[model samples]
Target: MSELFPVQASEASRPLASRLAPKALTDFSGQEQLLGPGKLLRRLVEADRVASAVFFGPPGTGKTALARFIAAKSGAEIVELNAVTAGVADLKKALEAARYRLGQSGTKTLLLVDEIHHFNRTQQDVLLPAVERGDVILIGMTTENPSFYVNAALLSRSTAFEFLPLPEAALERILDRALGDAGAGLGGAQAALDPEARAHLVRMSGGDARRLLNALELAVLTTPVEMDGRRHITLAVAEESIQKRSLRYDKSSDDHYDHISAFIKSMRGSDPDAALYWMAKMLAAGEDPRFVARRVLICAAEDVGNADFRALLIANAAFQAVESLGMPEARIPLAQAVTYVAAAPKSNAAYLAVDAALREAEQGPPREVPLHLRDANLDAKSRGHGQGYKYAHDFPGHFVFQEYMPQPVRFYLPDGQGDEARIAKRLAVLEALKSEPKAGRKGEP
Candidate 1:
């Protein structure tokens, strides 16, 4: 792959990232876990025994770089394809070319698919047969989680290596290399960046080396030459060049779902601080505030329940407020609801009770309505719709014991918390009255 590109004498003609990319494992920085002494990947590449594998990680984590390094050392003809633009036809052509090359002179081909997660299931399946047959050694590079995006069968057949984001110290080392190398860096141009500017660049890059280098190049190329005939990158220049860092968030990706799950669990776990932190992250990433509000409402019912009835009201109010007022402002009510729900006494008794009843109903046919409990207004006298119904208002304490169901049934078991405690006591008294042995009365206790 290195020979595929013409060697350019002038470093300024090429992108800083391309010029400074590590050509070997020794040159590559970060990922000590994978590339350290005696690591599996390093041993495989060094021994020229590279197999079909997937390198998955965030951007600027060296997925493609590592793949190229392995191919260079493997002594195999590497064929690169961008999954974003390439279709099944392109994959078929590449596979056939690999087979032809292999048959002609016993040469091997390593297929490097960049952004392999972008390929649909069918496109990924096309590589499965060839990869299994060893027709082409497949190396897939993906920023997304391979488990969700790649075919299960394909994933099972290949080894998956995780490339983590470069740490700050590693990024700093890369910056120094790019600045000091004469042939492939800004050394010949005598470009210097201020300490403050360098710090800003490193921090804003969010552990992405490519982003840091691109911003540095833009700052150097655009800044006017100083009196000493050297380009100086200032803090202001760095800020202007990289106005905003690319957030590590994809709305339709795994991170988005994971964040939301964390937020909901935080609230349910009664951790207000954790809940607020996740909410802030989502809001900063431009998530829908209404979605947060809805989750709060659910948490109130499912977690707080009768233990703090006020929680549900507050959550509902917050939901309405969020609907009326869009974000920035809506974050207030959402935060308020989250805190209230977190502080409220927690109980899942009601949630559990409803689910239990629902399961019973689903397991069998619907229960029939008792004749005494049917609508009395609809021909009550002729059909005896309200037969055997006892009027509770006429009795002492405005309560009467009567069978309301054809068969006995009990679903709700209230937890003794807040107002539910009093309800539980009252239910005990009523149950006692209903169970007291009758003296002489018929159909009465």
Candidate 2:
């Protein structure tokens, strides 16, 4: 079985992240919400009352390190199994050993399963009995959301703690500590990092301590030794160490939904800049341009409505452009449509009117079309289908007061935004005409 905490190895051979793993709670950085004073997890670890729990979060967030720390503090023997490589047989073997240790010597085992979500449901079930009987304290770590990937029964039996990315301050403290520590860090190298270079590493690491340490190690080791026997890490060297900013986005997981939701909401909230930024991020991350175009199309019709009917036209054009052009070129039209919809005078009156009408049509009693408004071309005079229907074109304004529905219902209430203001005014005038006496009515025979 793998050691919970690997023995201190040659600093030259081991990676900086592995060598500098937190040995105690005080040495751990970030996750104050979970590891803060009086916190439940902290209390459990301090009292050796740790139970079956799932540690879930993005990569390089210290899930595995924290589990090792728990084992060290509680004096529990930890057996590590990676769900990616270890199968059902391996899991069963670990459980069997845990049971043997527990029964024979009263020594508790802490089973640390990394990427536990990769284990299939049947494989997960094998560990359930062991966890229930208190044979082993299961620390299942995953990057995926437990509620989505883990079995409901298994999830219910475990307490889930989410680890967030280390903030800038926490990462800075860790960097400073690592640079100054002579035992396991780069202190022996005597590297001096410029402030701008330090900021670049921290920002580019995307709040991942492991990533930060890796970059710092690369910069320090790569730089030539100066006359003063110190290696200076400039911003240019830092840039080369960690070239690209790490973006926490998975096309198939929570990041996908969260990003698109933000994109749509930004447009709805009338923040054109935010909408553009999200769109750029999605496209850069290889999101389908067509999908984004479709969302822009929806936003235009639903949010812009009659306030700016041209927004829908532009969005539709953008969708067509995406279909025809595809990628690189498609982003231009998509951005145009997104920004137009975001900046347009907003109104959801048409969207609300249709939904409200649909609800009444679905839940309320259905009403027949008024006889006057019925088809005149089919047996007109025979059934009075078109009788008493005022010919509005023969009168003033090309409109007349006439019953259109057997049971009248008012659904559309314009918010008087942009073009809808004219619509509201026209409707008000028509309403006044409806109240006029029949004697004073024009073109009435």
Candidate 3:
């Protein structure tokens, strides 16, 4: 057999990442920003260039794959080592081999080390000469912060590319691909995914493609199949496959969107119990705390508003707490925050105000600020800039007569809802004071 004609390896021997490993950048699902045209890695490969590089990200984010991919393309010799397995002596051995091979063959060297964060400072310093002299391109991968874990001497030489966890949509696509993949586990199983189960697989996997596929592989295998025309996997089967009993859960897939919808609607409907229930469901489902906090913050400002001003504060504080503490302990603060927001007085008055303002602003030239409100500090500024702008503090009760809104611009008509009803009354008195300033004894200078 000619050395030029390569044989594709059998399916079972391949790790899912290998079997599913995208042959080209085109086959790769995630890292669109990195793989899209004019991207960093793509540019280096296209130029037949070797840059000392480090890929920093969470596990299974294609870091090692990227290292190997670059190595294969560059016609370089790869020296592999896991930090856990390789000591200073083993590292020196690999360095010797890579350097010797490079010198003999006129080849560039790629040292693909996984969890390079595990390398001690002294161990890492050994490779500095090779990296600096361009004898080897050190392609290091780490799940931890490189700035903290890596030797500053070595860090200075490499370009660090931070990889991100795939989004839910990309994860969804990955799940489908894994199940639909013939060479992988799901092919002969007659598996038809339940909407909820599919979502569960994605949500539980938590944006790790390897995790996602492994769980989906496990889930489908656990499923009991039935023959309708062919063996079709069912919701019950998926439930059994996932958690053994089944959940009406899955964030991006089924229960994720559903619970969020339920939570929002529960708040809008002023059903605290339902809202809290949905909130708990989201947390238990491993929904990101920041995501949950973001929604509550929106609900506080948009759905509760002045009806319960403290809701926004609570929601914001909860977000901060979650960020500081992360999981487990953070859940308590999040739960307290959600309960507070849900129990608060309901009012869409603020959301309505913005919605109305945007609608009117988009409608016509009236969107422009009144001349009185325009910037007046610069050259050739008009006289009307602060002319009728009454000094409210100069009068009693810090109130004064003024037409701040020029004409009849009513962005927030108050809606006469909840506390807004009282706010509307106060606004009426202000308008009246402007109309008949003399009668407003409270506004007299």
Candidate 4:
């Protein structure tokens, strides 16, 4: 029930990211849209008027830091709970303590819930009354889309702010600050970062300030001081410190949908390079090869359509290859399918045609099949089902004019691209033949 704060570690022992966390808004590196001068969020925090709100975004974007800063500025008792670790009982205790403090000492508690999206509907619902009645100012932080994961009632009562990845310039500024700040930063280390090393850290951080600082700290702390009395962090040292760039991707979150959407759109837009890049990023981030293959297959059918009939074949082959041979080797077939689909002539005509026909079938009045086109074997002689049927194979060019449907409807207009161009020409000739009068009908007119 006691007010919870981030575990207090000694300054010397705490991680650089924790030690160098911004103590003031001025020290915060990024999120200009939210923390910039005269912004609504900044004004709210400055005025100590921040109530129930949700901060959602990728990590190292200053959500938690801002929450702590808000609590400090408003002089409110801050209670921190990680949804990953906290249960219903823990939540109840925090809320009860907040209510008691508010009533007894005229104090307000700022409840910071990290990864709030991990909480189920029941857990989220528990915070609604406290939030609605203003018993505690709830600050829910999540990386997932709040609208999807957070309860509707809880979300509606909260102001949601999306934090973006820190820009390169902001990240650079943070690196500079961390290096120069004598009190909380590594100014005492007297470490001189090589130009290439500095750029490598910034570029590989992927707009994450904490990642940049952590890598910088590791490079400096582990390297031996040179004769010049400075620990020199070269490009090699920086690479060793942050070996692999952690791509921002979660299989069940925004990154998964966004990356796939980008990949599909790139292929549809005929940008093979962009399509390949997104595909690689998804795969590198542990996306299933089969999932990527499935998307490629859909794109071929829906976007490539009949323009390049071969595209669908290639996509299907790629899907089969992915299933047979997984990972590293599967990437080749995926690349082949992605590039082929992206470069192929695109036409959604076939896709559109089926959808338009579906709407008519589902919504329009019912109509029976034309008598001539009905099953002839059942009642060819008695019912006159096939009496007037004109067999196209019996005529020249395998062509004949006949009513195939009770009510004719136009669908499947082919866009002139790839093989569809030849199909369009063939259809045009058929239309011309249909316009001409039959051999014996000219005298009657």
CA lDDT, every prediction?
0.86, 0.89, 0.73, 0.89
Worst 10 residues of 3 by lDDT: 1-10
Error of 4 at 100 (Å): 2.0
The residue ranges of model 1 lying beyond 4 angstroms of the native Cα positions read 1-11, 189-195, 224-232, 364-371, 377-385, 391-445
lDDT of 1 by residue, 17-131 (tens): 8888788778888999999999998888888888899999999878888888787777788888889888888889989888888899888999898899999989988889998
Q: TM-score of each candidate?
A: 0.85, 0.91, 0.54, 0.96
Which ten-residue region of model 1 has the weakest summed lDDT?
436-445
Q: Which candidate, 3 or 4, has the higher TM-score?
A: 4
Tens-digit lDDT string for candidate 3 (1-445) = 1111235777776556666766566656687777778997778877868588889876667777777667677777767778877888888877777678778987777788888988888888898888988888888898766887788889999988888877788888766776676765456666777787677666665556777666566666555565563345555655554453223465544346667988888877778789888877777767887888889899899988877778899999999999999988888888888888877777787788888878776884574455556666762255565445556666666776554564556666666666767777888877677666353456432
Candidate 4 weakest lDDT stretch, 10 residues: 436-445
Residue pairs in clash, model 3: 199-253, 250-256, 251-256
Candidate RMSDs in order: 4.1, 3.0, 12.7, 2.7
List where candidate 4 sits over 4 angstroms from the true fold.
Answer: 1-6, 439-445
> Total backbone clashes of model 4?
0
> What TM-score, to 2 decimals, does candidate 1 have?
0.85
lDDT minimum window of 10 residues, candidate 2: 436-445
Clashing pairs for predicted structure model 1, backbone only: none
- In terms of lDDT, model 2 sits at 0.89
The deviation in Å at residue 113 for candidate 4 is 0.4
